[model samples]
Target: MNRLFVMMAVLLAGMSAYAQSEKRIYTKAERKSAEERKFQKRMETVMDSINYADAVKALEELDFVLEADRLVFKRGETAFVTSNTNFISLSDDNAVVQIAPFNGGGPNGVGGITVEGRASNIKMKTDKKGNITFSMSVMGAGISATVDLSLPKGTNRASVTVNPNLNSNRITLGGYLLPKERSSVFKGTSF
Candidate 1:
């Protein structure tokens, strides 16, 4: 009787071990699905790395365009604007800031004012975790403003604040900062 009981215990243990091992074996469809998922994950990682590098290069070179998806005012008011017509671009020391929100027409024949200025007192900083902060004073034909831009780690999305030197009202732009080649912004006539 003891021998039979010992044999039964050994059999049960073997069955359980087999069951666990069997769970790891994938069917043909399951294996293919897993492979595809792994491939997608790898591609996403590679793409993210490339985008992060591009953003870093754009910022360091001071040649980038910021397409504002939303315009935020100091009073907490927000307005959605067309990216192509409303953008802030900085290339070398030249900065062009435009805000055009019209389906028909407004200012500059597009919607709003397009101010082209010279960026000065430029300051750029990068943190250990790969975040960047940039600030400069822009003085031009119609506006004198200080622009502060922040870019988070591993992404091209940015928030930039434009504070005019002589006004209490400030505008913040939330958008993506991209190299000029990747940017799809349209320039309106400068005011």
Candidate 2:
């Protein structure tokens, strides 16, 4: 009886080991999809708390446009000054936006200029009619701009304008951002 019980325990341990090994590891595609889903879910929850009307109201309190220029040395006697002007808008959801770089000004042009930055923990929500609203904490720059946006109904596409004050840094007029649909923005280009 002792011998039989020992053999039974060994067999059970082997079966458990096999079961553990059979557990599936997620493929790269599956992992990416899961991550995307989590991000979307988080965005939805954040958006739910947005108030589009108040966002619009706040825009009235802002200066509406800000311009800044900086001087930089190139190589030889030629120096260039880069000037940027931001037109901003606010949504009830809490989004800070900058005008998208256009044909001559985007990163694709020769002697291209790119300004890369990030804002942390901005909030947003869409109205029942599909108007989005949001706020943002401008990072790196000492100033933050608030906006109100009137987005198109039935779609996520909207025109944004921002007005920032650089009174703090006396240089960078900063604000939040609301991203447009990546697919639409990246159309005809490899993203």
Candidate with top TM-score is: 1
User: Using Cα atoms with residue i matched to residue i, what is each candidate's TM-score against the true structure?
Assistant: 0.78, 0.29
TM-score of 1: 0.78
Model 1 segments more than 4 A misplaced = 1-38
lDDT of each: 0.88, 0.38
Worst 10 residues of 2 by lDDT: 182-191
lDDT of 2 by residue, 45-133 (tens): 56633522333333333322222122212222322222233333322332233333343544324123323224434555668875655
Best by lDDT: 1
- List runs of model 2 lying over 4 Å from the truth: 1-113, 141-150, 167-191
Model 1, span 1-191: residue lDDT tens: 99999999999999999888844678999999999999999998887777778877988899999999899989999999888888899999999988876653666778888899999999989999878999999999888999999998877888999999999788999888889899988787787
- Residue 64 Cα positional deviation in candidate 2, in Å, after optimal superposition: 23
Candidate 1, position 152, lDDT: 89
